[model samples]
Target chain A: MSQWLTLFQKELLEMWRNFKWIWVPITFILLGVQEPLSSHFMPQIINSLGGLPDGAVIKIPPPSAQEVLIKGLSQYTSIGVLIIVLTTMGLLSGERKSGVAAMILVKPVSYESYVTSKWVGAMLLMWGSFLIGYLATWYYTGILFKWVPISDFFASYFYYGLWLTLALTVTISLSAMFLTSGMAGFLSLAIVILMNVVTSSLSNWMEWSPAQITTYANKLLLTGKIPDSLFPSSLLALVCTIIFLLVGIFVFKRKELASS
Target chain B: MITINWGLLAPIIIIQLILLVVALIDLVKIEKTNGPKWLWAIIIIVVNIIGPVLYFVIGRRNH
Candidate 1:
């Protein structure tokens, strides 16, 4: 128990001392502020453009408060996903690159504890950034539209955050198993894009493909209807999470850290 | 995005399984080399689901 705490503390301190905390929160906050702000102002900006000299008249329809909120949340998802991927790309790979892993292994810490602590620390940072971004977006959207359901706003963000965090955690675990930090980050991004593309391409044939979990969660938050498709994807994501985490630990335990 | 299409899911699973099998074969062939076989195996098996990008980037033999 003491070792675990010490590991956690060391990991946390390394993360903070590295200034990751500052950059992550800054990035999330920027995403949060941009989402609702853009949704609220885009229409007005377009309208203010007036008619073109070529006789092109763009009729900009006013978006409802709900529409704006949903748009903002979706934008948040895009930016948040990118930030999570980049931030966690080297969570473990970086240590290996910097020769930190060899030194750490020489200490009293077990491989399980070391890897698990890194995982937990990464999760904490990811979740904390996500929550801050979600809350900021939710609050700003409510303020701008004056029609958001305040009671359900937090709940919706929580659900979305869980799915996003799980997806990111799996990505990080896979990244840790790879050799290069750049490869880890690139692979993580590719996996996300591939999931979306394959799922959409097969949407007509395969009603559910783990990718639907995000869409379903978004729908539930935006429309309040939980689709049956979400349940299966949710289960799949959970299973994948467990599998990836275990594999990561197994690989790390047997890894020759001195080589890196 | 939450829709059901078993047909789509089937191909995904099959593709991933095939990749996993190919990666395992590659792992066996390269196990005795000086390179890091486990790292290559993981990259090929796990990251190859997104294609062979990671494998090409970090898994292939350095020679």
Candidate 2:
């Protein structure tokens, strides 16, 4: 317990030093702010700068505030997810490569403490950045788009956050097991992208899978509609997160910590 | 430029500048990088959001 706190504090200090504590949330806020403004003004953007021969009528109805927020969320899933994954991909592997992990592990730390500390630190950055981004988007939605009910916004935010948590779990596991940072990132990203694509294609069997929780969040935010699968979705994701995290601990416990 | 709304645009610019400044500071402070350091400095300034992101993820190996 105490060991975990020590390592977690070290991880936090590492995050502060690396400037992730600043840039990542700023990036998220940037993306969050950018999404709604662009979506809201797209028609104006086209009129002012969209090159057309003298007269070309293109009808674009202003999207509903809900739709605008949803658009922002879709942005989060794509570029935002990619950014989140890539920035933190090196958490464990980089430590190993730089010999930081070996030094820490040498000091009577449990493998569980090492991995859990990484997980906690990554969560702090990921959740902190994401919530700030989402709140900014929500505030902007209220101003520039429409005032969505706070309940719907919070509900969808929790659901979407869990989905990202699942992604983070996979990333933590991959970073612990893999030696090379790039490979860990590539494989984790491939898994996330694949989950969305494959789960969509295999729609029936995977509908209740955590892969669809993101879609659920979007829908709930856009229309305040709750899918019946919400509980099953949460349950499956929680189970998977715990299982994968435990597996990562198990793997790291046995494997010689990163050699390079 | 007359049509531009500076009020609306200011927040975006501020956030981006924050990212840019932090990235530049880190690039200068770090002792070494995965690639040439000068290229990273240029990329951080020119490329907008993606520039600093890539530099942090790839340029300096995390300590």
Q: What does each candidate score in C-alpha RMSD? A: 15.0, 1.6
Model 1 steric clash pairs: A205-B5, A206-B4, A206-B5, A206-B6, A207-B3, A207-B4, A207-B5, A208-B4, A208-B5
True contacts kept of 1: 0.00
What is the C-alpha local distance difference test score of candidate 2? Answer: 0.84
Candidate 2 CAPRI assessment class: medium
lDDT of 2 by residue, B1-63 (tens): 226677778887888888999899889889999889999999999998889988987787745
What lDDT tens digits, residue by residue, belong to model 1 across residues A56-103?
A: 666666666666656666655576677677667777777776778779
The lowest-lDDT stretch of 10 consecutive residues in candidate 2 chain B is B1-10
Task: List fnat per candidate, in order.
Answer: 0.00, 0.65
Q: Can you tell me which runs of candidate 2 are displaced by over 4 Å?
A: A258-260
Residue B28: error of model 2 in Å? 1.4
Off by over 4 Å in 1: A47-57, A204-206, B1-63
lDDT of all predictions? 0.66, 0.84
